[model samples]
Target: MTVFEQRRQALKESLRVRGLPALLVSHAANRWYLSGFELADSQCNESAGWLVITAHGGDTLLTDPRFEEAARRVWSDEIVIYSSRKMEVVGAFLKSLNPPALGFEPRSLCVRDYERLREFVALTPTEGLVEDLRVIKDADEIRRMEASCVLNERVMLALPERLVPGMTEAQASWEVERLFREGGASGLAFPTIVGAGVNAALPHAEPGQDRLPAQGLVLVDAGGRLDAYCSDQTRTFWLGSEPSDRFRHVLALVREAQRRAIEYIRPGAPIAESYHLVRRFFEEHGVADRFTHGLGHGVGLETHEAPSLSSQSRDVFRPGMVVTVEPGLYWPDWGGVRWEHMVLVTEDGCRVL
Candidate 1:
């Protein structure tokens, strides 16, 4: 069987185990992951397509007229085309099944669409049916992600050379993009973030007119995408010949925190342990409040996926999972410093990707 076929088969068994006769895949990434339909829905109200998988080995692709050709190239068995109303077409099909209810991913449908679909058939909300499978990377996916990570690291290392004192954050961000493209990446996993000086305090700060001073800190969070796989990492660098005592201390603390967290990852390990390890380290240093956000998240077809590393998460590590380990400290007045790296969960421990 092709990889797509094998994935669908696995999903079929999941439905059987859940007492679901069928499933409606609405999330764009899940659709692509299951069927190889590369088109994406740019807006929440819009859709490139949907997959209706049946436990009885049924394979169906539902899309609009704009995606008919592309849908055929990916799925050859059954294709349903909707011209003006997608929910109506979808509802009618589900009603035909005439089961008590059918399972669908709530993450895929907006509230407006979900309400409309409710008028036609009983809907069962399901989560992680496909994601549980996607989190465990296949051999080919691991290889692709490794290549993307390698390319991403190269671009980040070269960013310092392309930047200089007084360069605007926007200019530095553009240079990061150029390096990734020139390094043979198809695209960026997400926008390159270049936060200079105090601007880095904003975790998701947008690259702006803020300038890198003669002696300050620069935090860059970036990633490259190759062959539909994604890579993500962050680095915080100093500008002066010698970093201030405070900066050196915080940097070392964060680096060590990150080191211990990475070492804590392994098969069957609690997902939240890695996150708590970093948080506890910061707390000991009396900077716990400054360490915002989770330790990291899984990376693959999407920049962020399942098996998240966060105190609120209830997952456990599993072999073949690719996740990031990023521990950061952000100070509104002093900017921020974040160290991120990707690792592959293995049988014994994890390998730094």
Candidate 2:
């Protein structure tokens, strides 16, 4: 069977084991994962498309005319086109089958759709039916992700040459996006962050018109996507001839924390351990509170996915899982320092991408 068919079969088996008759999949990513169909949803309220899969391995795509042709080209046999009355069409199909129970992704379906769908058939909320499968990358998926990572590193390494002393943060951000496209990337995984000096204190700081500081630090967090797979990385650069003693120390600590966390990754290790390891390291250094946010998260078709690395996460490291290890320290007065690395979980340990 093809990869897409295999994925569909796996999901079907999960539904069968759970005693579910069918599933109504609304998440765009989950739809692409199962059917090889890719379409961007304009907003949370707008759906690019939806998939209805039966427990016995039957599959169908319900989409508007705007995406009908493309869906047909990708999944010809299973395409259903409807301009309006989306729920009416779906209800007609469900009524014909009249299965024991119907499952749906609660997180993806909006309230109106969910309430309307329930009026036709009993709806059972299911979580991570497809996402659990996504967390584990197959051989082919790993290859595509590696290609994205290589391109991201190349773009990052070449930035020093393009960043002039007086360049504005917004200008630098634009250059990063341009470089991603020129470097053979399909697009950026997320908005490029180009924070200089005090601006770096905000972890997700928006790139502004503020000019680069005469001296101090510039922190860049960026990534590129290739073939829908994503790569994420971050680094802090010293802009002056030399950094202050405190600045150097904070950078060293963050780097060490990131390095240790990455080295600790191994199959079966609890994901929360990675977060605590970094937290403990920072706590020992008396800056534990400064280490804000989770340690890292899984990366793939989406920049962030399952198997999060954080104090509250319950996931365990498993082979074929790709995740980022980013640890940072933020100080209002001193700005911030962050270092990130992408690693692929393997049987024994992980390979840094």
Candidate 3:
């Protein structure tokens, strides 16, 4: 069967086990995962389309009139177009089903939409049904992700050649984006972050017009998307000269933490174990609080996905999973250092992408 078909069958079984006759998939990522329909909304409130999948293998795509032409080209399933009153159209569809239990993604839908949906059917709130299935990548998915990762790595490798001291952070960020596009990436996985000096302390700092430091850290976190798969990597580089003793020490600690985290990745390994390894290393160095964010997250259709690597995460690693191992230490006065790399979880261990 086609990959989309196989995914649909898997989702069907999940719905069956949950005693749900049908599922209303609203998230763009989940929609794409199920039907291979490639469309996204500009904001959380907006929706390009929604999918209604039945246990009997029926797939119906509901979209607005604006997306009618594009939907027709991408989706071969039943297509319904709604104008102003989306709830009315959706309600009609659910009424036709008369399902005793209809599954819907509470995390994906707004309260207003969920409340409206409740008026039409007995809605069952579900989370991660599709995301759980997406954690494990297929061979084709891995191929696309690997290509993206290769493009990302190439862009980083050429940084020394293109980057110069005093170049604006915004300029450097644009250059990285250009490399991704020129190298055949569909688009950026996330905004190219080029943080230098004190600005680097902000983990998700936006690129600014500030000039690159003459001799300190420049943290670059970038990614590209190829065929809807995402590649994410971050590297901290010293400008002009070698880093200070403290900065160098922190960098070494972070790198070691990241190395141990990546080494701990394998099928059946608890996701939290990798995270704890990094946390413990930072704690041992008396900089535990400096590490602010989670170790990493699953990367694929979205830059961040399921099976998060965090202390609170109960998820376990599985073969074919692509995840990042990023350990960082931040200081407002001294700047921040982060090292990120993508790895594919294998049966025994993991392969650095």
Candidate 4:
């Protein structure tokens, strides 16, 4: 079934199970997921661009006239469009339907929006009513995400060639972005991190005009997006004549840690175990504290999503789940080494894509 149809079916099932008569999807991403209507930037105005889906399969798209034409062009024929100046009209319309138990996305609705919603209808906070359905990829979603990964991998493979010894970090960053777009990416998944030498110790360092050292370490963390799905990857390189023994040792340990984490990932495996395995590898190298961050995270519509791989995470690895296997060690006096690869969890094991 189409993504929208599947979403509608899932919502219907959720509403039936929860005893809710209708659901209001206010979050932009959730709305896009349910209705396939991309909200215009102006839709964030009070009560505009809201979607109300009834338990009985009725769908309505409420927005201002500014977005009527765009909404018609994008939404399905089943989605009835409502134009109004006052934002309260959406709530009034919902109340007019008089749903017994109205649902709202608890994770997406802010306190301010929740209070505003309370002004019109009784809203029952719903958890994962739509997000749970979105965790698994439909064929089209997977296709777009795979295309995004391909572009990301291509950019990663090409990054080394652009890293001249004297090029500024900002210069290299601009080139990387240019290459991503030229390579068919819609845009960078997030802000690019290009750190050399001492700056490499910072995990999320911003790219700057600092000229790269002729003989030091260079760490690059970047990715790109395609069709709204995202791909993230990180690779640390030796820009000098050759990495020192100390640097090589750190790189080897970090790569080994990342490898072990990926190896331990399988269907039904606890995410904490993978993180612990990475920590153990670092501890063996006497750099446990240097590995501060989580081992990995799920990547899809968002660069970082569910099923985080870390000590605090209780999520179990499942088949068809796309996650990153990244482990690193950073020493303030020295530098940092990180190896990241995006992989798909399978029945047997993870397959890096």
Candidate 5:
């Protein structure tokens, strides 16, 4: 069977096991994962298409006329065109199926749409039916992920040399975009975060007018999308020949924390342990509170997916899963350091991409 068929079959089996007659897939990535449709949703409020798959058998791709030809190319047998009011057409299609219950992802559907969709049928709000399958990467997916990571690293490593003193954060951000395209990436997985000096303290700080200093920290968090897969990475660079004693010590700790956490990544290892391990390491240094966000997240068709690595995550390591391992210490009004890399969970351990 084709990969798409295999994916749908797996999802169908899940539906049968859960006693769901049909599943309404509205998430853009989930739709692409099952149907091989590439056009992305322009916005969360606006959908490019939707997929209705039954438990026992049958499926249909519902899209507007603008994407009729594109949708038909991926799903030839059943393509329903709706010029406007997608939920209205979708309600009619579900009524025609006449299933006792219909499943949908609550995270994907807006509240108003959900209220509208339920008026026509019994709505079952399902979570992670498609996402659970996405966490594990197939062999082909691994290849694409590997290639994408290679592209991301190439751009990341090259940027330091090109960055000149007095370059604005926004200008540096543009350089990152250019490098990704130069490396033949389809696009960025997320907005390139270029923060220098005190700005680095804001983990998700948007690139701004802050200029690169001759002797301070420059933190870059970036990702590139390629072959339908995504790559995430981060690194902090020192502008001068040497960094301050405190900066060196902090960077060392973060690197060591990242290394130890990665070594602990393997099949059957609780996903949350990795984050706590780093937390403990930082706590020993009395900087645990400074280590703000989660350790990392799974990366694939989406930069962030399932099986997260954090104190709150309940996932476990599984072979064929790809995730990022980023650890850092940030101080407001001061420079920060974050080191990140993508790792593929394997039979024995993990491979840094």
Candidate 6:
């Protein structure tokens, strides 16, 4: 079955088990998953669009008149489009049905939207009912995500050749983005990180006007999206002479840790085990405290999603799951080194794409 059908079936089962009469998916990602209609373009258009799935297998696509044609073009026949000035129209429709319970995404909906929803109908906050349903990838979603990964890999392979010593970080970032678009990416999954020398120490550092160091480290962390799926990667390079022995040691350890983490991942393995394996590798290298971030996270329609692979996460690795294995070490005065690769969880082992 298609992803939309799988999602509908999952939510239908949840509603049945939870005794909810229907669910009102207000989050754009959930709505898109349920109805196959992407309303992101209409986020700022003052149109309160939503996807409603009834326990009785009824699916409706609620939107303002402006999106009537667009919604019709993309959604299935079961999708019932409605014209509305505000989301209250949907709440009013649901109230008229007098359903016993209306489900809302507690994690994605804001306090303001929650209050507004309360003004219209009774809402029961639900955590991860829909997001959990999205954790597993169907054949189609994985295909799209793999395509995104391929695009990202190609873009990164091309990026190193463009790095000139005099170019500012911002200029280098722009070049990478241009290459991404030219290589068939829909857009960037996240803000590109182009940090040179000490700036590379900041894991989430932003691209700036600082010039690239003549003989130091240059870290490029970037990703691109295709068909709403995303890929994230980080690669650090040397500009001139070989890096110092200290830098080389850190770089080698980081890469080895990332490799070991990927090798240790398997179906039914606790994610924490893989995290600790990488942590132990860092600790053995005497840079354990320098590693500040978790090992990795799920990559999908959203850059960071579910099934996080970290030291504290309790999720067990499962087949059909996509995650990144990124291990790094940073020093404020010096620089950081991280090597990240996306992988797919499998029955016997994991495969890096």
Best by lDDT: 5
Model 4's TM-score against the true structure: 0.91
In the range 1-353, model 3's lDDT, one tens digit per residue, is: 87888999999998888777998999898998888775467787789889999987578999898888888876787998988999999898888888887888988899999889889999888888899899999999999999899999999999876677899999999999999999999889899898999998999989999999788889999999888889999999888777799788988999999988887888898899888988888888799999999999889999998778889988788899899889899999978999999999987889999
Candidate 4 lDDT over residue span 236-308, tens digit each: 9888687789888888888888777777888989989999887887777788999979988888767877768
Q: State every prediction's TM-score relative to the real structure.
A: 0.96, 0.97, 0.96, 0.91, 0.98, 0.94
Evaluate model 5: give its TM-score: 0.98
Residue-level lDDT for 304 in candidate 3: 90
Off by over 4 Å in 1: none
Question: How big is the RMSD of model 5?
Answer: 1.0
- Assess candidate 3 and give its TM-score to the true structure: 0.96
Per-residue alpha-carbon lDDT of candidate 5 for residues 179-295, written as tens digits (9 for 90 to 100): 999899989999999889999999998999989999888999999899889999999988877788888999999999999999999999999999999999999999999999999
Weakest lDDT window of 10 consecutive positions for candidate 2: 74-83
> Which scores better on lDDT, 2 or 6?
2
Query: Quick one: how many clashes does candidate 3 have?
Result: 0
Using TM-score as the measure, which candidate wins?
5
Which regions of candidate 5 are displaced past 4 Å? none
Task: Give all candidates' CA lDDT scores.
Answer: 0.88, 0.88, 0.89, 0.80, 0.91, 0.83
The lowest-lDDT stretch of 10 consecutive residues in candidate 6 is: 39-48
Report the C-alpha displacement of residue 178, candidate 2, in angstroms: 0.4
Which tens-of-lDDT digit does each residue in 1-353 have in candidate 2? Answer: 87888998999999889888899889988899888887347787888789999988568898898888788877854677767888898788777778767899988888988888787898899999999999999999999999999988998898887776789999989999999999888888989998898888889989998888767788899998888888999988877677889888998999899889989999999999999999999999999999999999999988889989989988899999999999999988778999998999999999998
The predictions' CA RMSDs to the true structure, in order, are 1.4, 1.3, 1.4, 2.5, 1.0, 2.0
lDDT score for residue 253 of model 2: 98
